[model samples]
Target: MTDAQLGLLVATPIIIVFAVALRRMGAVRTTGAVVAVAASVAIAAVLFFTQ
Candidate 1:
């Protein structure tokens, strides 16, 4: 994988965890958090392969 793709692989989970923590802290709504996480994964998957 390219550097950017590797970076994304590393970053995506960190970001997802961070966002989940935020949601648990009541800083984000459940619906929004779920959608964001799903979209993040989908986007990362698409970019990781297509690029």
Candidate 2:
């Protein structure tokens, strides 16, 4: 796999785990999770397209 794909594969799970941890710790709400996922996806998309 390409670097972008590898990055997405790795970062997506980390981001999701962070979001879940934040929610459980009351550091973030549902909206925060949504935003985090959206931002991660957007970044992944940029990496994918720019590569």
Candidate 3:
């Protein structure tokens, strides 16, 4: 995979973890979690198409 794809793949899990942690810590609400997951999926899709 290209560097961008690789980066996105790695970052996907980190973003998920961060979102979960934020929710657990009461820093992020449900909307924030949804946004975070959506953004990560979008990024992955972009990387997939571009690669």
What is the TM-score of each predicted model, taking all chains together? 0.89, 0.72, 0.80
Sort by lDDT, top down from the best: 1, 3, 2
Q: Select the stronger candidate by lDDT from 2 and 3.
A: 3
lDDT string for model 1 (1-51, tens) is 799899889989987998899899999999988988999999999999998
All candidates in order of TM-score, best leading: 1, 3, 2
Report how far residue 33 has shifted in candidate 1, in Å.
0.9
lDDT tens readout by residue for model 3, 1-51: 788878888888898999989988999898999899888889788877888
Error of 2 at 4 (Å): 4.0
What is candidate 2's TM-score against the reference?
Answer: 0.72
- Number of clashing pairs per prediction, in order: 0, 0, 0
**Number of clashing residue pairs, candidate 1:** 0
> Could you tell me the lDDT of residue 14 within candidate 3?
92
lDDT of each structure?
Answer: 0.91, 0.85, 0.88
Off by over 4 Å in 2: none
lDDT score for residue 29 of model 1: 97
What lDDT score is found at residue 24 in candidate 1?
96
